[model samples]
Target chain A: MADIVLDKVSKSFPDGTVAVRDVDLEIADGEFVILVGPSGCGKSTTLNMIAGLEDISSGELRIDGERVNDRAPRDRDIAMVFQSYALYPNMTVRENMAFPLRLAKLDRATIEQKVAEAAKVLELTPLLDRKPANLSGGQRQRVAMGRAIVRSPKAFLMDEPLSNLDAKLRVQMRTVVSRLQKQLGTTTVYVTHDQTEAMTLGDRVVIMRGGAVQQIGPPQELYDHPANLFVAGFIGSPSMNFLHAAVEEERLRTAVGDVPLGDRLRRELAAEDAPRELILGIRPEHFEDAGLVDEQTRGRGTEFEAPVEIVESMGSDKYVYLTVSGERASAAELEELAADVGADGFGGGAANLVTRLSAESTVAEGENRRLWFNLEKIHLFDPSNGRNLTLHEGRAAGALAS
Target chain B: MAASDTTVAAKWRWGLLDVVVVVFALVPVLWIASLSFKTTGTLTDGNFVPREWTLDNYRTIFSTNQFVRALGNSIGIALIATAVAVVLGTMAAYAVARLDFPGKKALVGVSLLIAMFPQVSLVSPLFEIERSLGLFDTWPGLILPYITFSLPLAIYTLSAFFKQIPWDLEKAAKMDGATSGQAFRRVIAPLAAPGVFTTAILVFIFCWNDFLFAISLTSTERSRTVPVALSFFTGESQFEDPTGAICAAAVVITIPIILFVLFFQRRIVSGLTSGAVKG
Candidate 1:
């Protein structure tokens, strides 16, 4: 296993289009790091640069403390699992797995032993004699993984490897990949646009946008403490709702109601040159039905009544889409985030808030219901720069836990 | 019930068309076969079937030096031209399909222009150039033009097939520690074999069927192919008819083509239609 480091690496095409910017990343030995972003965000390009499949326009790439920027892909001693599986169509499963070993000129007995061991681990023993064209999508994916792991390369670079499988099979193979990575402990750099995979698979997730790094942290840390407006909107599903608010004396005033600032937020605002207008960011799950909360717990948060436009019950939780009477929060970062997620537009006119409520709560569609939002969990962002004003110091200290 | 009746009538009409097509294609071949089997006395008898059946025509052609030598020249030239054209075309087509280089479109455009160019227009010039270069009447003379003319066809068909292959396999090979040459030989070349075979068959047929180039270029029996040699055949003496021997020689040259098509019909169909649809 090896630790791979990208020291301010950047990739620009001959046509002067930058795919990856000056980004520095250090992946330790045996660590699984995920590079997650929307399409055209340079996640895959970064992975390709590390694999030496793509030339780095600037900066250096180091594998196991040796500079490998100028090395060929084969000379880098790394294996990659492509999104298409990329199994050799003409070769059987055994030969596919034995390819790297054969290229390395290993003896026949050793190559056979290694392929057998890998096939067993990947549950491909029964399929060793079958060509990839005869295999199902999931089987082909396992064969791809088998091909990568059989060589026991210094690191594994995977570019959205599970994206081609059906949803259920993808979930199943996700665990399989996780188990294999843990068992082998190979330094792995995985790239995907799916946030769920990034959350469930990586020791740390790096979020990128417009060919630049937005934030890098553990999934939970990024979810709880996003660095900017783009990261806040991109990290979570039923994405974090943003509402335009104006800073008042000790509270933030929005069309829904006044949200009183906590002591920490107040102090932070007082210390910095705060902007007059701010964007209040709240996750869907951070909201609860006011009626379901006990009086003691309800005292800790702010409550407001808004007309619910739609209610989708997902068995365990209720998603209440509410239309608050206010202008929607608009910023370049929010627009880019909306476009990235393929959203038509963020709050065409009035603010639309999606709140996750307990299923037991008696909330109905088209009814005004009281919703309580956790004030302490709320994130405040400056409207002009989109920088999260409420982010605390030392928040990313726990980002690199393996 | 009415729909079923219509379907039955439609099937009957389609069967009638099939019979017409079969007759249209096989009649000339049957006529040649009949002529080859006819005795010299019945050569102009105008009977569809031979009145006097004999194997003398086949025996006469086989026994002569002219027909046999021309047959050898035809086979040698066609095979060599097919081999060279397919190899060169495969390399060019693979580069066109997989690489991003300047003038790529221009290369494809030039090949396409060559494919569409009238062959008769180049015959006179090629004739003069071959004579000046001392390539006239030799195997290399015919082989050179054959390879040149068949290259565009070979390139168009092979490149279409190459484009159908996913480029990801090459990257996977490289990541697996195989060098670029190994990647091509081990991963790409095997996948492209059927396409190459289909192109070879096409190039061979083209070279084999070209009577113009063979007759225009060769001045002697040394390099005269079967098609050109067929025109020179008159029975053993000036008075005797050569139709029977010529028909027999035509049947001999066609047998290889028929066998090739019959054996590789499925691969040829797939190779031709590979890139017309997305997988």
Candidate 2:
């Protein structure tokens, strides 16, 4: 196994559509890197190019630092698990997993042994003789995994393998995939449009948009300290909320109210020009019920009431949409603010902000529009570039508890 | 809930009415079957069912020379034609479906045009060609004509079938180290079997029922197929109203077609629908 590197990669379809453009990424040996983006954003295309399923339109692709632009998928020693699973619907589970080995022309005894082991690994021993049509979605995904595992290739390329499964199966399969990746320790490049999968599966997730790499880092790093607004908005569920706020003598004031700028934000703005307008990003779980509320508490850790517009009760937590001070924030504006710190005004009507609170925290919709957010956990961004001003350590701690 | 349940029951009753409409369309085929089973005496009597049941009419025809030979000839030609059409057509279909060679689309388009061409238009030219090749009055002559006539339909249907196969299977086969040819042969061919069968069965029925080509092309008994043989059973100038013989021959000839249809009807319907519809 060796590091897979793409130096300024780009793909242009015959129809003159550019799927990915000037993307640069280097995955270390045995690393689990996920490419995440919105639908049709070219994350899958990038992975396909690496797997040799799609020819690179432009750029250098190197496996082990040796360029493999012309190599076939098998010659590149890359195994792919397709979004459709692409299991041989006609072939039995054992045959499907054993196909690559069979292609490798291994002896019958060896092929059988390898297939058995793969089946055992995937808990498909009982399903070995069954065709893909008989397997459940999760089981088919595991069989797909088993197929790649049997190859023991330099790297595994997976394209949205979990998308076909139901919600619960997708979550369960996430853990299975992570454990499998760790156990195999083969360099893997997995692509998914789902942000939660990107965060949960990748050691380092590469967030992509419009066939370009937006940012690459550990999952929490990208989530907490997203390099730009797109990464910030695209990396989290219900996404990050962006609000238009202005800096005034070490204090930032918004339509809702005023809050003091903490040392972290002020210091990051110290060497640079403190612009009049700034974009503030807040994650879903950063808000809480107001037990303590004040400018001092808001400076680092405080709470304030914002009216709730929508409430979605997930079993473990409640996702509340808060319109701060009746100021409307477009998703694009929020995304832009997340990318460019000290950004210009995105203030419109009512700002749409999402908050994840404990399920027991009964913030009933239509009961009260008001809710509270923790200012200490709030994300400060430049309105112009959507760059985060404060690099708080708490941002990188882990996934939000909720 | 009760109101909704009543509505659903009413909808099912409407569905039953639609099935009755469909059954009305099938009355003619049922009538023809009933006509075939009756004695000529009953048939002339205009009775739906014969009061006097007799196997003598069926027995008389089965024991005759022309009817038996014609039956054998029809089966042979249909079988040969279908086999050739399916094998060659499936390969041609796969090539047209998957390969990126030059003029591929044009070739496919030309084949479709050939299928839609009236069989009578080609009969004279084909007869002359067979004559020059000295293939007239031979099995090869018959096979050649049937193959040409059946091709466009076969290729058109099977190509549609081939298109339905996920390109990924061929890619997976490629990943499994099969060359393009091997991938087509091992993966595509097997996967497309039902469609091929469907195409073959339909093509066979076409060849079997074709009297114009079979009668016009073959000169004598040495090469004459079922239709020619059956027409001869009618006799020349005598105007012999061997109505029972004709009916018996019709029933005999139809039995195999019916059996063939029964064997592959489900597959034909499924394959045809699959080719036409997709996600």
Candidate 3:
């Protein structure tokens, strides 16, 4: 295994479209680095440039501390798995995996041995002689992965290798890929638009947007404390809810109502915000159900009268959409504002909606006319910059609520 | 849902139109086959079917030295042209489709330039080049011209085919420890078989049917193709033979082409469709 480093790399096409801009990443040896982003975010382009399948318009790409900018793909010693799995449809799995070894001019016996070993790892021993057409999607995916890892290349590059599979198969193969990466410990650069896969698979995930690196950290680091609004919105399942709010006379003011801020929350908010207006961020799971019968937390937290617009049941968790009354929010701050709105008027601005409330406390549509929000778990951001308002000492440091 | 239903109805109407197309297109082919069995007096008849049937045309065609020599020349030229074209075309297509080169854009431009021009326009200059190289009136002369003309068509179609092939397969091959050339030969070439075969079929048909180059470049029976020899059926020294002889000669000349189409028809049609649709 070898470390792969992209030193200040940038790729701009002849059409003047910049695919990747000033990307500087150092992938640790034997670490699985996943490049995740939405389509046109240039994650795939970055991976391709490293594989030498695409020209690096400017900058150096080094594998094991050696320059590879001038090297051909074959000479670069990198294996790739494509979305189609790209198994030579004509060749048997044995031949498909053995293709590189044979190209290396290795003896037939050694090639056969290596093929057998890779087949065993991929549970493809029975499919050794089968063409790609004969294999199922999951099996084809394994072979694609096997084809890359068999020869033990310096690094493995996988570009949406499981994207073509059905949902269950994708989940099943996601585990397989994760297990295989851990077992083999090959330094790998994987590209995908799927956030779940990015979080679940990578040793470190590099979140990209608009062909620029927005944030790079461990998956949880991005999730628990995102660098900016884009990373916060892009890296999580269901995404974080954002609401526009203002600090007025030491009270959290909104069209819904005023909630008194505790000294600790006020102090944290003061440090995070040097300006008056702040964007509030909150995840769905952080909220609690303040039932009408409960006295301990009821009216004790920031209680806003909201109508339940929709309810999505996921067995362990329930997502509640709320609509607030008479609060006209800016388009950018609509989702966050919708989270605290009553269930009746909360859902029109968004499809996925502003707020996803958790199971025990989450209100069902037309069931809970008024909903409450937890003030302590609330997050604040600068509306102008989308930067989360907080002094992050580290991942352990919590964002003080104002 | 209502809009989608109308599209579905329109598609069915188009399907019916396709059936109408098949019959309309087959009329000329059926008529040609019918004429191949009739005698000369019956050939010009107002009726579609002949009053008499005979193998006299077949006998006449087989007996002619001109017909046989041209037949032999055609087989040699088409085969030679196809082999050279497929080899050169597939390799060049693979390079243009996969490899990054200093002059790749130039190579593609040149290939396109060759395919875009009308073949008749280059007949004079090609003839001059052939004469200067002492390749005039030889198998090499015809094959050279055929390659020069057919290479671009083969390359253009085959390059489109190559692009559809996932580059990952080649990269996987390289990771397996093979060089770029071997990866193409082992992984790419096998997958490209249908495309290559399709290109060869087109190249064969184009070279075989070419009349201008064959008539201009070849002077004697030694190098003349079947189309040129078949021209002699007009009978310069005597009355032209009636329908049976001419039809028989036409049928003989058409057999190889028919067989070629039959063998590679599926591959050729698929290649053409994939190229056209993807483009």
Greater DockQ among 1 and 2 belongs to 1
CA lDDT of every candidate: 0.88, 0.75, 0.76
Runs in model 3 lying further than 4 Å from the true structure:
A249-251, A259-274, A292-301, A326-364, A367-374, A395-402, B1-65, B91-141, B148-152, B233-248, B262-279
Q: Which regions in candidate 1 have their CA more than 4 angstroms from the true location?
A: A248-250, A262-274, A394-402, B1-12, B236-241, B262-279
**Residues A266-381, candidate 3, lDDT per residue (tens digit)?**
66557754657666666776655555426765544555566677777877777776666533334343333233232435445433335545556536567644555665555566
lDDT order of candidates, top first: 1, 3, 2
Interface RMSD of 2: 5.2
lDDT by residue for model 2 (A119-162), tens? 88889999899877766778878888898889788888888888
Which residue pairs in candidate 1 have backbone atoms (N, alpha carbon, C) closer than 3 angstroms, thus clashing? none
User: How good is the docking of model 3, by CAPRI class?
Assistant: acceptable
The candidate maximizing TM-score is 1
Q: TM-score of model 1 relative to the true fold? A: 0.94
Write the residue-wise lDDT of candidate 3 on B26-89 in tens digits. Answer: 7666676678777766777856666787666677777878888889999999999999998999
Worst 10 residues of 1 chain A by lDDT: A393-402
The alpha-carbon lDDT assigned to residue A279 of candidate 1 equals 91
Q: Which ten residues in a row have the lowest lDDT in candidate 2 chain A?
A: A393-402
TM-score of chain A of each: 0.95, 0.84, 0.86
How well does candidate 1 score on lDDT at residue A304? Answer: 95
